[model samples]
Target: DTAVSQTPKYLVTQMGNDKSIKCEQNLGHDTMYWYKQDSKKFLKIMFSYNNKELIINETVPNRFSPKSPDKAHLNLHINSLELGDSAVYFCASSRHRAAGVNEKLFFGSGTQLSVL
Candidate 1:
């Protein structure tokens, strides 16, 4: 009964490697967001997609790119993974078009990425 789902709950990779995390939502939301939680448990927005269009892109590294195939899916691909990139990546969605800021977002259980 998960509204949002992400693959590979645990990811272990080497430094300078590349990896991808896939996300999907079934709530028919208009906006999807990617967030990263660092070691200190601080969460920061990385990217956002509204109806498969890029809307908000924070000052993330160029090696990190987000691709949304449709309104239901958002994928994050990271290249040249660094030690600082080790964190928990979360996928969340909200009905930005309908509820504005009042809508609560649904977030997937994050993918824990560890760089060796």
Candidate 2:
């Protein structure tokens, strides 16, 4: 089984439509994250949640939201999906939030979102 998994590997939608990408991990991790990769391949951490609290990256827009009901899942919801929102979203999880060289982010295959 994959450590991290996301649904709808490909998403195609028109402008103004709302869509959600779901993520789940079975790695026994405490920290889960959502990242967005734009057309330029610039990857940015959009949200990071550790158990009960959420930490949003300052640069991320308000349209993006991350919800975690428990430690093993993190779901991403994009509001008013726009063309600029088109990108590959990645779900990842790590053992903990502590900064350690050995700490690794186990990522899902990724979801490709295209807004027309």
Candidate 3:
């Protein structure tokens, strides 16, 4: 019984390759998000989707795109992967759409993406 799942927990690849990280939630949540944590452990919200509609797009590079086929899943697709993009990509979810501000995020173990 996985509450949230993200594939390729460790991704190592050469630069300029296109890669995608998949995510899924079985917690019956209405909102899902993607977060990136750098080597310094500073986490930043990348994108968020509610009911398959994008609600937040942070100051991320155009190479990064998020897709949600349904409310339970949100996947991250990265084109022209670069060294700067190497970070721990986390998939998170909340019970309510507006509950993020107050509620703690339920995060996946994370996809440690490494661009060589």
Candidate 4:
């Protein structure tokens, strides 16, 4: 049993193609998030959802969209993937916060996308 799992750890593709990364969490958490780690190793939150309701949008490109079927799964869909889009995508989950302060986040290994 995995706490969180993502497929295709390495993704290599040309520009303008569309790709989707799937993520699932076994933890019975109500909050899930997506993070992008750039070449410089800067981790930034891309999006977050609580109980299927979006809670955060950090000005990411429209090409990147997150879909959460339930509280345990959040998938990312990228349209017109570009070279600049190359990065490591991480999926994370946390228990619902009491008064908006969540507990430690559990993260998936990551999906590295390479655009050429």
Q: lDDT for model 2, on a 0 to 1 scale? A: 0.90
The lDDT for every candidate, in the order shown, is 0.95, 0.90, 0.95, 0.92
Candidate 4 matches the true fold with a TM-score of 0.94
- Best candidate according to TM-score: 3
Each prediction's TM-score versus the true structure: 0.95, 0.95, 0.95, 0.94
TM-score of 3: 0.95
Q: Alpha carbon lDDT of residue 51, candidate 2?
A: 88
Residue pairs whose backbone atoms clash in candidate 2: none
Query: Candidate 3 lDDT, tens digit per residue, 1-116?
Result: 87999998999999999999999999998999999999999999999999999999999999999999999999999999999999999999998888646776899999999999
Clashing pairs in 4: none
| Residue pairs in candidate 3 whose N, alpha carbon or C atoms collide under 3 angstroms | none
lDDT of 4 by residue, 1-116 (tens): 78999877999999999999999999999989999999999999999999999999999999999999998889999999999999999999988843355478899999999999
Instruction: Tell me the lDDT of model 4 at 79.
Output: 100
Badly placed stretches (over 4 Å) of model 4 are 97-102
